[model samples]
Target: MNLVNMQRKHSSYLLAFFTSVALMSVGTARDLRDVTEPKIPPSCTTLKASGGDDTETIQKALDSCTKGKAVALSPGVFHSGPLNIPSGVGLVVDTGVTLKAITDPALYDLGAKTCGTVDDVGVGCKAFITMLRVTGSGLYGKGTIDGQGNVTLIGQKKSWWDLSEEALVAGTFQNVPRLIQINNSADITMYQLTLIDSPFYFVTSIETNGFTAWGLTIIAPASARNTDGIDPIGSQNVTIAHCNIRTGDDSVAIKAMTAPSRHISVLNSHFGHGNGMSIGSEVNYGASDVLVSGLTLNGSLKGAHIKSNTYRGGHVVNITYNNVCIVDVKNPIYLEMDYVHLHGNRTPEFRNIAFNNIRVLSTGIFILQGLSDSNPVVVSFNDVHITKGSRWSRHFANVTGTWEEDASGHCGYAGNE
Candidate 1:
């Protein structure tokens, strides 16, 4: 029992401690892997190959699904009027399946309903696929949703574009229906789908929460009217990621008319030929704590724009745009409180908007004009470089904020950049 015995005992103790620690680590890893639910991929149920007025047929398929079921569409065209998607169901469109919307206005139109006004956009009765109070559901696939936006309606020589323009000019548009509508729902996911040529907004959500949309291709003609891509209204804890959008209107527009939309994040997406990511052209209620990151906006009309008329305006605060690259965009970073929709008195409250690490190429008239009564509070920027535009071409009025200078010497504030 001398020094050699004591050293041997100490070595044995160290070995025991190391072995226990390694075993504990392996056990923790196993527990982490076990916490995730066993994904069953849902039960697969295919829709029937009906030829005409597939609304009732498709409704039957959707209604026949048990909770958390997968209803798939086969490889062909299924013409449908208006349809309903049940809750706790996942819709899968196969590689060649196309759910074509019937343009026979009478088929889709239930009755004369009010269109998108101050706080009433997604509340109407006529949508291609409507899901109300549907929870824990998903509509995803590698297929297409053909809205036939270019078709000429009955008794009209021109296509939907010309008709839509006429409606916009006349200030009363009730001619088209939206592609997909999800209202007052939660825990929904939409992914990897081609939503094209809608009569109105391609995909819209209202009063919903915990929504996630990704890998979507939303495209329409530039001449097409009001075809917005991923419109999220009054939804919270939402994440839209890796979506490509080329539509006639806003690619990712955040609207809050009836309820406030908060804690929303849009990550790693591309937008073009549209009104870029926007907030509150119709923020009638309020919005807060929204984040957009890793966006590539190419050849679009506006990038990170916020447009609202005085009458249909409310608070939009604590927004952040980070690591964005805007290429060949016109009128990048525009904020107009007085959008030409017949002005009113109540000003919108905007505050704490930050753009970090933004790179712009080829833009015209970077304007941020907030109303005098409701000056936006502290719109700051960091590492924003506009390489292809002149500083004099940029316009600013009444926006009281602070921003770091881009390489082109364009600052966000009136003082030295």
Candidate 2:
């Protein structure tokens, strides 16, 4: 305790470690834009819309509805088949209703019939609003749930987006049927619903654990085929907010194949013409704390995407994209790791990615590939703005900061389908 009282006790321990790192960065920015807009419980049974197969009357009012109530559905057309949704109940759909989804591949086969066919073991159907192993379920509404996928499958003639483009010209896999399938669920939700034309993947959620999709709206067609908008596989503490998502594939895919998808959050979304906020081509069991905020991507074909390969590889770390904008996108910032080249060894790790205040108002193509040269792909950029003839490419990525071409703003939502 000599030298000036030991430098005043090391300046009070660096002022209490910078005040505990500014309170843990404001609690991780409120856990990445805290979302929560779900409250619609209280109805335990409403039904009304018997213009045909209401799938055993909405599966007997969601199997006798009870736990935390909700069965509504009133208003109009509802042709269901393949329902489920039990534990903790919920399933609104009011305001000029529409439910639909009865393309009848034997009502979503899953019984060795290989569903709408296109084989190679595509999991044979089943999913027109299922919520297996449920807990605190949900699906509130303001209407639609279509999945008509351009209707025409009763006996099959194609249409489920033409058998998903004939299973991509017979390379196999297409058992279709998926419009809200929430497996092994827990605290799931999907408020302000709309979800349409999904012959497959439009709100998936496997191994879920506290999922949430607020102000939803999804509408497929950009040549719909695997119309995904809001997938959250191997989920955990997920939250997709203010959704609008016009899809045809990946409007918001954040998969982690069997487990391990960490605290995710996508806020203030908009994305039109899908394939925009993606993260992986399966992601075999690895995906870390992701956070995308205030997105906008219009006419998207890919913007802020992160697709993997090496046969559904793993490990995508602390991803973040803030205040994005990207208009008329066509690969705005695609981070690929040999996406379709497949081949596996399980090694596909993208590192601490970050891009704040992005802008990119046109002139697309900025693919940043990696998975070689000693495995690079660690990114970072701060006020990234891109417009002037934007078209940059990278191979063994490891980029960091700086990206301005002076992007002129304007992406206040105006994305159609």
Which candidate achieves the best lDDT against the true structure? 2
Candidate 1 residue-wise lDDT, 343-416, digit = tens: 67656776667666777755455766666643643355445666543332222332222233344433221111
Q: Model 2, poorest ten-residue lDDT window? A: 1-10
Alpha-carbon RMSD of each model: 14.6, 18.3
Q: Write down the RMSD of candidate 1 (Cα, Å).
A: 14.6
Q: Which residues of candidate 1, in runs, are more than 4 Å off?
A: 1-40, 113-125, 154-159, 392-417
Clashing pairs in 1: none
- TM-score, every prediction: 0.81, 0.34
The 0-to-1 C-alpha lDDT of every candidate, in the order given, reads 0.71, 0.80
